[model samples]
Target: GRHQANDPRPSHFEYNGVRFGQDNLNVFAGLCAVDTPEHVEQMMKVLRDNGQVCTRMGAYKPRTNPYAFQGHGKDCLPYVFELAGKYGIKVIAMEITHESHMAEIFEALHQTGDPTGVMLQIGTRNTQNFELLKIVGRQQRFPVLLKRGFGITLDESLNAAEYLASEGNRKVVFGLRGMKTNMGDPHRNMVDFAHVPVVKRLTRMPVCIDPSHSVGTRAAGPDGMLDISHVVAQGVIAGANMVLVDFHPAPATALVDGPQALTLPELPYFLEDVAIAREAY
Candidate 1:
């Protein structure tokens, strides 16, 4: 259904006492390789300083690479949650696997002392599983932040959100990352910021951008942050209500997608000129 500006149709919800998509603009740093309490604390510091939030997983995901890092799974979740609790930071997490482990995932989320309020993240790989999407939306005890499929179109992405909403769940905020294309381009992925305004106009789902996964290149240049920030500025101006980016305490030593993750200390500067771009163009 179409939405009016006064209605604020897609309202944000609180997770673990932290809110997303409110009138107050907020950002979240996706923590993929964050595996320790110390790193979690450091991440919270980054989030606090930048006024952002982070999402780390409970299960160690190596993702098809036989030689990926498999840290402590549920065992590590508790520590990360404990540290996040202390920092007044929000967390968006992937629920381990599908059904067979739903009970365990719920138990893990509940132990965070925030089952009913935490943010549930569904990554691209699991985007089209209608059954799974329905479960996450219908039975979910918390707010959901759904990610766009790297290979999906704008409509397909919105349909994923509609998948949840159609199932009696209205607490959803759709995420728009990037799509992959072979347009004689060398960039690893295409950041389709154009979809931002489109989605917002169609259904009132607050749109969020993920430049980390959208960049066409997996290789970082000397001035990586500046380059990424330039694109990010374009996204916000295009009508993105929020952003979900990946950053690591030490990018050079990260375990997953090292090239795309922002250096912990590089965030503030990236956000510096964004407002100027927003106001000027």
Candidate 2:
């Protein structure tokens, strides 16, 4: 928490008139400890409360602390999707670390009509995970959210995308969260800002920015919400095809990454600015 530095001031607010970014964004409302029928119910509640039509449902969790919940794993997936239908929330479940779990991932999709399509997110731990990538790509039921590694170079990051793309999975979506760990600074991870445009130029697929992880703090500390507006706008201008912003109905009460979440009122207003920023690109 003691690692904040004087970054540039947030840019002026600008609302562009673009119809939409290259790909319309789907805010990922994650459920980490969803292990029972009750957790499923809570998922729907959050979705409804936020007016969120869908989410990335995590039945099996990977947490840094072992004391954390590993979730009900595959046991609660169907029930999760079942509740989603009951609440009209499209469900996206994560696969277990083993190929054996692929069965359950597809099963959930099949049972749910797959909604907007299940997403195979390659988390930081899975950046260089080729075996997993090949396996996820093998499934045709969903798209992917390929998060860049903490310190992975831009080329290496794009190359991971290339591997997925080569498998003919055009639905691959690239995510950025910047690299700052090796620098021994607490300035939050600076997303590979240039990746926004670089990936767009090298591949025909879509790209989006994950700014919550970029600056690390969700609150607009000294600068205010304009800080978010400026960073996202510049990201778009720099060639980010789309944005993957994380927003919650309430930030302080969030179970995960609460500090980084933008308030509900903040999202649309921010998107208005993002839509405008994207128009400039």
Q: List the residue pairs that clash in candidate 2.
A: 16-276, 178-190, 178-191, 196-239, 218-260
**Backbone collision tally, model 1:** 5
- TM-scores across all candidates? 0.83, 0.72
lDDT of 1 by residue, 145-259 (tens): 6888878766787788888888877667677767767795445577788877777667756677777767723454577644567667888778676677777787677766778
Tell me the spans in candidate 2 whose CA falls farther than 4 Å from its real position: 1-54, 83-98, 112-116, 184-187, 226-229, 249-253
- Say which candidate scores most in lDDT: 1
Evaluate all candidate structures by whole-model CA lDDT and list the values in order.
Answer: 0.65, 0.60
lDDT of 2: 0.60
Off by over 4 Å in 1: 2-19, 22-24, 53-62, 70-72, 93-102, 115-117, 216-225, 274-281
For 1-281, candidate 2 gives per-residue lDDT tens digits of 00123323221111111112334444454443454476457656756765666455556656668886665767776777677667766535343555666677677668766533455567766777888777777765566668777766777877777677667655666777677677754446765667676665555445667666676575454656545556777787776754655555545655555566665555446656766766787
